[model samples]
Target: MNIEKARFNMIEQQIRPWNVLDKDILDMLIVVKRENYFPQDQKTLAFFDTELPLPDGSKAMSPKLEARIVQELGLKKQESVLLIGAASGYLAALLAHMSSHVTVLETSLALKELAEKNLAADGVRNVSVLLADGLSGQHTGSYDVIVIAGAVEAVPETLKKQLNVGGRLLAIVGRLPVMQAELITRSADAAYDTRSVFDTVVAAAPGAVPSSQFKF
Candidate 1:
């Protein structure tokens, strides 16, 4: 199959109808080359809007899901961002284009290294790949934006705390049919506000912190 035609179909048929209308993001998708992030065996299926398998049995979030979250984060050109579950650094690369600085945290050593290599090859200097359990929060400074590549049963408390007063986070919450893609923001009032962006499911990060039984 022709890769360009497939990409155009993905952007037009799958992503665009999902409310990913920003021309810049659409253009970035075209330039970033998703196939480069996929395992060679699966490269031909890169733009199929389906999760691609990883060595650890985990999976990359689908193109549509990625588009939805990227669209929801609404990154700015002069903002520092934190990314959880940096698989192959594709999302981080996308964020690097729109944000000033990005810190990508990944639990898997192999994935972290893979991300670093890909980001460097792409000249995405604004992103740093860190080995850490991103679910619990690893940084101290205020971040203007955060994007979690994997779905979680609940948003970690510290991740919420890490956001600056006006920072925003895009993550998927819940399980199965109840799974919802959400955008959480630390409002100026020092309160968190959340809104569902769409319905989707993605593999939970390998070492994601599980919420307490009481957390909803």
Candidate 2:
């Protein structure tokens, strides 16, 4: 395969059309080789518009979705970021380039190791991969940005509390078949404002089970 051509096609045909118009983000996608984050067997699917399956039964969000999420975050060079559901560290690798520091929380120990390996191989030095349940929301220190790498039925309040004032949290919320990607910002006086950015469905982060629905 013509690697550069394929990359360009992915940007033009897939990502750009998904409303990911940020030039910096588009450039970053070119710089960070998505194929490097995938396992050998799945490398061919790197630029395809589909979620790639991971060993832990999780799925990496499509390239367009990943780019859209990053673009929506509007990250600054000095902001600290927390990434839930690290998966194979592709998103963390991307976030590391745009933020001062990044901490990735993963539920699977094997996946954590895989993430560390991939990040290190890519020379991503600003990220720390930790083995922790993403749904638990137990961690030290607050962050200027938090990105949940997958969908959840709802954004737990515990996770919202971990964001610093003026910080933003991005996540896909709702059930299967449809979901809304939302950006929630924390303001002074402990208030939060949420705005729906787009509608799409992706696999739920491990441990982020949907809340039970009551029947009439």
Candidate 3:
């Protein structure tokens, strides 16, 4: 693949239409080489506009979805981050470039292994990959930013609590075909304020505990 041209096309065609515009975030998407993170046999599918299968019952979010979320994080070099649903560590690798440290929580042991191998392959060093149920929001430590790679009925209160005061968590909330990417920020009163960034859809976390409204 002519990586540079493909990268440019990916950003301009796939991600820009999705509303990702930060030049730095755009540049990072090119530099990180998404194809490098995919299985060798599946490298050609890296830039497609659909989710790619992963180990366990999981799927990597489409390239555009991943770019959109990373762009929305508005990461800072001084901040630590939490990433739910590490998938194959591709998104985790991208997060590592923009944060001081990243703790990725995965629910599937199979995906945890894929993430470990992919992260290692990419030489991403500051990420701690662990297998944990994201809806439960188990933590290794607090973070200045939390980026959940999948959608859920709602952001777990536990994950919200893991954010430092003034920290932000980016996630997809609400039901299919109607979900929106939301940014939740911590307020002085220890409450959270959320707003929609863009409309999107991805596979929900495997073990995400849905809200009562989702139960039938």
Q: Of the candidates shown, which would achieve the greatest TM-score relative to the real structure?
A: 2
TM-score for all predictions? 0.92, 0.95, 0.92
Point out where model 1 deviates above 4 Å. 209-216
Q: Higher-TM-score candidate among 1 and 2?
A: 2
Error (Å) of candidate 1 at residue 55 is 2.2
- Residue 1 CA displacement from its true place in model 2, Å: 0.3
Clashing pairs for model 2 are none
> lDDT tens string, model 2, 1-216?
877888999999999999999999999999999999988888878989998888777778899998999999999999999999888888998898899999888888878998999999999999998888766767756899999888888898888988999999999999878899999999875799999999998888767866774244
Q: How does each model score on lDDT?
A: 0.82, 0.89, 0.83
For candidate 3, write residues 102-182 as lDDT tens digits.
Answer: 988877888888888888888889999887876664554688999878778878888898889888999888876788889
Q: TM-score for model 3?
A: 0.92
Which residue pairs collide, candidate 1? Answer: none
- List the candidate numbers ranked by TM-score, top first: 2, 3, 1
lDDT of 1 at 201: 70
The best-first sequence of candidates by lDDT reads: 2, 3, 1
